[model samples]
Target: MITVIGTGTGAPLPPDAEAALAGAGLVVGARRHLAAAALPDTAARIVLGPLAPALDAIERFLEKLEPEKPDERRPVVVLASGDPGFFGIVRALAERFGSDRLTVHPGVSSVATAFARLGLTWDDAVVVSAHGRDLRTAVNVCRAHPKVAVLTGPGSGPAELGAALRSSERVLVVASALGSGEEGSDEEGAEGEGAGGERVERVTPAEAAARDWGPAVSVVLCLDEARVLSPVRTVAGPPPGPAQWALAEGDFTHRDSMITKFEVRALALARLGPRLGEHVWDVGAGSGSVAVECARLGAAVTAVEKTLDGVERVRANAAAHGVDVSVVHGAAPTVLSDLPDPDAVFIGGGGRELPAIVTACARRARRSVVVAMAALDRVPAVRGALVAAGLDCDGVLLQSSRLAPLPGDVTRLAATNPVFLLWGVRPPARSEGVAQ
Candidate 1:
């Protein structure tokens, strides 16, 4: 049988795991795990680099055991860091060998260790992995939620994450060398010093990005200190979401009828699919209603507006909803170049530059783009922009009417101006490139 043993977080290997390691004819793991275990010099070993070959080696070892001669078969042990099942090497092994033929020994995950070091509860924190994936989503989670744990990878480490979230109020807790012998070896007699080899350094995003950290960083905990005890939640990570979305016009303080209608916002949000670990841009955000709603739905949001008054309104609206939203007081099609690419984009008001803004947003949107326009003249141009960006484009004109009280006791329908909402979705087979 193939056995996977978890080896880190300062936890001692259980007796069964030790016995398995001792008897293992073939031990496959990283060099550190092998050295720490002190396996017999005679035992065959593979220093893990490219994991596929290591798995192949394990498969060969397992093949020798398939014969009817059970006595001749030798044990194959795979050592891993943290609970292998938790984004570790066990997945690949289990997939190669049937679960029935393999046994797993799990230990404390580094994420758990990091939280424990800070004496914080993680049932409410969202956990995401930037390993072998994108780091922007992890940054979005940090912006939308109070807390999150990000599993670091080659390029998606603390520095990258910190740079993305530098403008946000969240703090980066760089938990490095977790469960290692030299965790807090030299950085002692300081205010924010760690107790041992497991050191957790809390710093602002700027501070985190300024230094060059070692490769020992296993996990980084991005936290919002203001939300530590915001509320007692029954569920972990993001909450179940608001009972309803596309809040009414009266819900937000807007000048004249500048806000996007509830009907349009609802449909826009549906096309955008804003959620945790995703970023949504509300270009030309008027009163920031759409931005606030996106943030409420657990998506990191940025409202880009050129007017000073509009910027203040967006900020006030975000504050009233009790959610953090980055308010960029600048015009789009220019400012959007520097901001992180978005999973979705909603263009509410781009004025004469509507087509340019739509094109800019479409090019950067990784998933989908939705645009709302009242001027029929802008529909073809906006649709053309999305189509040019390789997004499958479609649109509909919406006409709404409210009941108005007549003089006697009768009522009549008061029609509002018809609006056109054009949306485009990137094909599932295609991947969007990040625009510098």
Candidate 2:
């Protein structure tokens, strides 16, 4: 049997884990874990680096156990940091050796510890790991949700996370050296200070990006201070997705029936596939209706509108919906240059420059580009642009009529203008750069 112990988050090992370690004949773990533990002098040890080799070493040790005397078999123990079962080595161990052969003792997780240090509850916060994955997903999550805990790794550390969120109005709480008893000052002092070797320092995203935080970082808390303390939730993880989407035109403050109709909005939302941990661009966001709807669905959205009234309208609509959308007040094709690349693009109101805007958006869109238009002439050019950008393009013409109340208290069909909806999806081979 193999024993797994989770420790190193400033907590003493439970008696069971300590007892397991004492009887271990072969111990395997990171160098820090090995150095911290009180292993028997006779115990053989392996310092973990690459995972496969460590598992191989453990397997070899287990194979050598004498089958004749099951009672005499010395235990093989693996040590990990802070709840190995949570995004840690437990899965790998369980996969290699059957789960039946392993006994796991979990410690307090860093996310739990970090929140404890701040004296805040974390059940409402979204926790994401950037280790061995793309930083953008974490960044996008940080953008969409008010509270998040990010597990740090080599390339996806505080500086990288901060760089991505520098423009956003988020506060980064860097928790370093957990359980080490290191001393740190509370510069912001908004939240209570870190108590132990865990030095929790709060800084703006820009400040975080500017500093070179070394490998000691355990986790980073990205918080929108305004909404940090949420209403007590019955369920966990990033507040469940909105109950409804494709809100009607009356729900938003739009000028003179300029909003995308509910039918088109519903189809556009389906093609866009906005979700948590994604970035979406809404070009020519006329009423910001699409932008607001996208934000409501949990994607980090940027709504670009050229006219001053349109910009104000978009912001107002977003505010009314209580969803956050970064409003860029400028025409598309040019303004899109300064924004980060998007997983999806929605074009709603590009007039004469429709084709150029579509080309610009298609080239940078990582997943799909969706264009909704009323003009038939612009379809060919937009299709050509999507094809040139190497996207597998498809389209549909939507014509719908809704029931209207007549003077006689009867219902009649009210025909809405037909709209052409085109969407271009990036081939799978070309869209593996980001993770959601």
Best by lDDT: 2
Model 1: lowest-lDDT 10 consecutive positions: 184-193
Across 68-92, the per-residue lDDT of candidate 2 in tens digits comes to: 9998888999987778888888889
Q: What is the C-alpha lDDT of each candidate?
A: 0.83, 0.86
lDDT of 1 by residue, 244-317 (tens): 99999899989898999998898998999999888999999989999999999999998899999999999999
Candidate 1 at 120: error in angstroms?
0.3
- How well does candidate 1 score on lDDT at residue 217? 76
Q: Give the Å shift of residue 258 in candidate 2.
A: 1.0
Report how far residue 288 has shifted in candidate 2, in Å.
Answer: 1.3
